[model samples]
Structure formats: C-alpha cells, structure tokens
Target: MLAKRALSIVGGLAVIGWPFAVWLVISYAELHILLPILALCFVLRLCTLRGKTGALSRAFKGLAIAGAVLSVASIWMREAQLLLWYPVVVNGVMLALFGSSLFSSMSIVERLARLHEGNLPPAGVRYTRRVTQVWCVFFIINGSVSLFTCLAGNVHWWTLWNGMISYLLMGLLFACEWLIRIRVKRRYE
Candidate 1:
C-alpha cells in the first residue's frame, strides 16, 4: 500500500510537470524519449486510480488511456507535432465529460455542490447547471487556443501557453466562479 501511494504521488507529479519537462528538456532530449516517459506517467496514473465507477472516475481513466495512446502514436509516427496535441486532447476530453453531464440527471457541478450542501434548492440546481455550461464554454475556448498554439509551430509559444498561460486562465475562471458562487449562496439563503 505504501509503495502504491508513493508511486501514485510520483506519477501525479510527473503528469502535472509534463509541460515544464518538455520546455526544459526538449532541447536536450528527443521527442521519442519524452513521449515514452509521458506514457509511463499515464500508466502509473491508470494503475493508481481509486476503484470507483462514477463519471468522474471514468473520465480520469479515459484521460489516462487517451494520454497513453497519444504518446504511443507520437513515438510510432516519429512526429513531435503529435506530442503538442496532448493539451488539446485534454481539453476535448474535459469538454466531453462536462458537456455530457449537462444532459444527465445532475450536472457535474451540481453533483460536486451536493457534496458540500446535501440538498440543493431549485435555484442552486439552476446555478450549478449554469456553472457546468460555463465550464463547457471554457473548454471549447481553451481547446481551440491550444490547437492554435500546437499548429503555430513555435515551440516556445506552445510551451508558454500550455505551461503557464492556460493554467492562469483556468485559475481566473475558477476564481470568478468562486466569487459568483458566494453571491449565489447568499441569494439562495
């Protein structure tokens, strides 16, 4: 158990650090080398997942599998361009997961909100659904930008956007939603 936990932590860090690693090492290393290392990270993540069949868990598993496949394809085709597409894939998968949840009985945000407040009022449900919709829009915009960066063929720009700017944009969205959530909570109360 301890070993698994340690591996999980390492895998998590490697997955999160991928963009920085690419930025720092791509000059020194070959794309094939980096791609296999990424594949290893995905396999470790897949092995470490909790034994849940919820939509969130399934989404995680799907992401790991997709990441591994992308890495393998990059290696097989001997094309570094495929490596840059990882961020786009990440956004596409996220959009699918969150977008599909909108049609389900509960939006993903509603399910998460319920974890904090056991029974959400009607207004809260509407708020959560709206938040989910916003997330879908964010994913679409982010993914399109990521695709643009990947195709632009400027490695530095790709690294900056994928490694730094995209994260900042996500944080901005999260912060805005949090502030909005406070207002929402007050209104419902």
Candidate 2:
C-alpha cells in the first residue's frame, strides 16, 4: 500500500512536471523516448487499483488505457509530434468527464464535497453544480488551447502554455473557488 501510494505520488508529479522537463532539460525531444517506459508504469499502477467500480473509477481506467496506447503508438511510429497531442487528449477527456457530471445524479464537486460535509444543504448543492459547470467550461477552453498548440508545431509555445500557463490558471481558479467556498459555508451555517 505504501509503495502504491508513493508510485501514485511520483506519477502525479511526473505528469505535472512533464512540460517543464521537456522544455528545459530534455529539450532534444527525448521525452517521447520515455513514453513506452511510462506506459509500462501506467500498466503497473492500473493493476494496483482496488476499489468498487464506479463511473469515476471506470473513467480513470479508460484514461490509463488511452495513455498506455498512445505511448505505445508513439514508440512504434517514432513520431515525436504524437507526444504533443497528449495534453489535448487529456484535457478533452477531462472536459467530457466534468461536463457529463453536470447532468448526472451528482456533480463531481458535490461528490467530493460530500466526502467531508455529508449531505449538503440545498445551497451547497447548487453551488457545487455551478462550480462543476465552471470546470467543464475551463476544460473545454484549456483543451482547445492544447489542440492549437499541438497543431502550431512550436515546442516552446506548447511548453509554455501546457506546462506553466495552464497550471497557473488552474491554481488561480482553485484559490478563487476556495475563497468562495468559505463564504458559501458561512452562509449555509
């Protein structure tokens, strides 16, 4: 269990740091060379997952499989450009996942919030739904930008946007949402 958690943390950091790693250190397009290795790691990680199969869990599995397949294809074809498409595919998948949650029985944010807060007040439910919608829109826009950067064929631009700018924007959103959530909780209380 500890090893699995450690691996999960490392994988998350690697994904987060990939753009920076590619841009600054591995600027020679050697990043794509690691795809196959990463795919194997992903396979190992997926095999370790143990839980009830829910929609969210299934979606995560789908993403893991997709990443593994993309990595394998990049290796087989020896095309570095395919690596550029990774963020686009990821963002698109996220857009779909968050968008679908809006109309489902529980919004993704609500589901997460419930884990801490128990059954939400009516206002809390409404707030989570709106927050989920905001996330869906953010994903759509972020994915579009990712697609544009991939097609633009500029490594520097892709690195800057996907690596730095996107993360900054996401952090800003998270901060703003957290501030708002405090207010929301106070109002409900």
Candidate 3:
C-alpha cells in the first residue's frame, strides 16, 4: 500500500511535470534516457489507474497509453523531435475528454459539482454545464498554442509555453471560475 501511494504520487507529478521533465532532461541528458523514463512514468500512471472504471478513468488511461506510444515512436525513430509533441497530445486528449462530457446527460463539471453538493439544483446544473463548455473552449485554444510550440521546434520557447505560461493561464482560469462560482452560488442561496 505504501509503495502504491508513492508510485501514485510520482506518476501524478510526472504527468503534471512532463514538459519540465523534457526541458530538464534534454538539457543535460540524452533523449534515449528520457524516453525510457517517460515510458516508466506512463506505466506508473496506468498502474495507479487499476480498479478505476469510468469515462474519466478511461480518459486518463488513454492519455497514459498515448504518452507511451509517443515514447515508443521517439525511441524507434531515434528522433528527439517527436518528444516535443507530448504537450500537444496531452492537450488534445484533455480536450476530447472534457468536450465529450458535454454530450452526456451530466457535464463533467456537473458531475464534479454533484460530488460535493449531492443535489445540485437546476440552476447549478446549468451553471456547471456552462462552466464545462468554457473548459472545452480553453482546451481548444490551449491545444492550438501547444501545437504551434511543437511546430516551431524551439526548445526554449516550447518549454516556456508548455511549462510556465500554459500553467499560469490555467491557474488564472481556475481562479476566475472559483470567483464566478462564489457569485453564482450566492444567487442560489
């Protein structure tokens, strides 16, 4: 159990720190070494997903598989350039997951809101759905920028966007959402 928890923590960090890892490793080490380490991260992520079954779980598993596939491709081709696309792929997968949730009866945000509120009123449901839509839009735009970074092939620029600027934008969005949610919640109360 202890080992599992540790692995889970490491896997989560790997996923979140992927671009940074790429930047750091490729700076001092070889792509060959990073590829295997990245593959291990994906495998660890997959192992952590064991026993989870749902759309969200499947989405996460798919992400790990995609990362592993990229790792394999980079290794096979001996092309470190392929490693640059990892962030783009990540954004695409997230876009798909969150975008697909919009078509379901409950939007992803609605489901999350339900977890805490238990019985979200109709207004809350609508709000969550709108929030989910906003997230979908965010993914589309963010993914586009990531693709641009991949295409540009400038490691410094790519790392700056994917590792720092992207995260900052996401944090800003999250903060705005929280503030909006507070205002919206007060309306329901």
Candidate 4:
C-alpha cells in the first residue's frame, strides 16, 4: 500500500511538473520518454483488478494509460501542446467516477467516511453526498479550464494553470471541505 501510494505521488508530481520543467530546463523529448513509463509504472496498478472497483473504472484507467503512451509516441516539438489535454482526460475520468457514485447506494465520500467512522449518521450521509456532488462539479470545471488553456495556445498559461494553479486550488478545496466536515460532524454529534 505504501509503495503504491509512493509511486502514485511520484508519478503525479512528474506529470504535473513536466510542463513547467519543459519550459524551464527539461527537454521536451526527455519528458515524452519519461511520461509514458511513469504512466505505466505508477498509473497502472496490478492490484486494482483485485479490488471491488468496477470494470468500467478499470477500462477507463486502461484507456488513460494507452492515451498516455500514444501521446508520447505522437509528440513532437509542434505537437507538444497536445500534452496539455492530459489533465483534462484525468479530470474527466474522475468526474465520471464521482458522478456515477452519486447514483449508487452511497456516494464515494460516504464510503471513505465509513472507513474511518464505520457507521455514518443520517447527517453524515447527506453531507457526504453533497461533498461528492461538489467534487463532481469541481472536476467538470477543472477539466473545462484545462481544455480552455490548451485551446488558448499559450504554453505558459497551460503550464502555470495545470502545474501550479490547479494543484493549489485543489488543495484549497480539500482543506476547505475538511474544515466543513469538522463543523458538520460537531453539529451532528
């Protein structure tokens, strides 16, 4: 579990950092070589099949990995801009996952909360669903922004938004949600 988490962290940083690094000192060719390997190495988990994850989820992951590989192969100096869509693809997949969960018995956030609390209260269930909805909307907006930046044809904006600003906004969202969760828990308790 630790190894998988570590691999994911490293791979995520590499993907998000690649654009900035490319604009700075890293060669685009070097990034192309590293990106696909990182995708397969850290993105594809052999253990994912063992989990209760849906086949559709697994298929989505496979598609992302394949897309990453194809992007690497097709990438050239002029076409390097195509790499900007990587985040959009990622967020789109996440949006699907979260959005689908909303229709299920329990939202994904509720499942994660249950892992810690074991049994969620009525209020908790409602809160989790709201949180899950928030995440779905966030992914949609984030993906849209990613697509817009790419289409705008500015590498600096693409690199800055995808590499730095997006992460910051995500962190802020997570922190704000966590704080809200605490307040909700207190009210329920």
TM-scores of the models, in the given order?
Answer: 0.90, 0.89, 0.94, 0.77
- For residue 59, model 1's alpha carbon misses the true position, in angstroms, by 1.3
Candidate 1 residue runs with Cα over 4 Å from true position: 30-32
Each prediction's RMSD to truth: 1.9, 2.2, 1.5, 3.7
lDDT of 4 by residue, 56-149 (tens): 5574555447445545644434355556667777788888888998999989888888979999989899999999999999999999999998
The lDDT leader among the candidates is 3
Question: 1-189 in candidate 2: lDDT tens per residue?
Answer: 788788777666656765664454235665555666667755754654556386667766666676667667767887656667778877877888888988889999999899899999889999999999999889989999989998888889999999989999999999999999999899879
Whole-structure CA lDDT of model 4: 0.70
Model 2 scores a TM of 0.89
RMSD of 3: 1.5
Clashing residue pairs for model 3: none
Candidates in order have lDDT scores of: 0.84, 0.77, 0.85, 0.70
Indicate the worst ten consecutive residues by lDDT in candidate 2.
21-30
**Better by TM-score, candidate 3 or 2:** 3
The order by descending lDDT is 3, 1, 2, 4
Q: On residues 1-189, what C-alpha lDDT tens digit does candidate 1 reach at each position?
A: 998998789777866787776665445554346778888888888888868588888888888887788778867886656667778888998999999999899999999999998999999999999999999999999899889988897778888888889899999999999999999899778
User: Where is model 4 more than 4 Å wrong at Cα?
Assistant: 1-9, 21-60, 63-67, 75-78
Tens digit per residue, CA lDDT, model 3, 1-189: 998999899889888888877776556555468778888888998899989998788888988888788877877887767777887877788888888888889998898889898999899999999999998899899889989988887788889998899899999999999999999999889
Number of the top TM-score candidate: 3
Q: Which residue pairs come into collision in candidate 4?
A: none
Error of 4 at 142 (Å): 0.9
lDDT of 2 at 101: 88
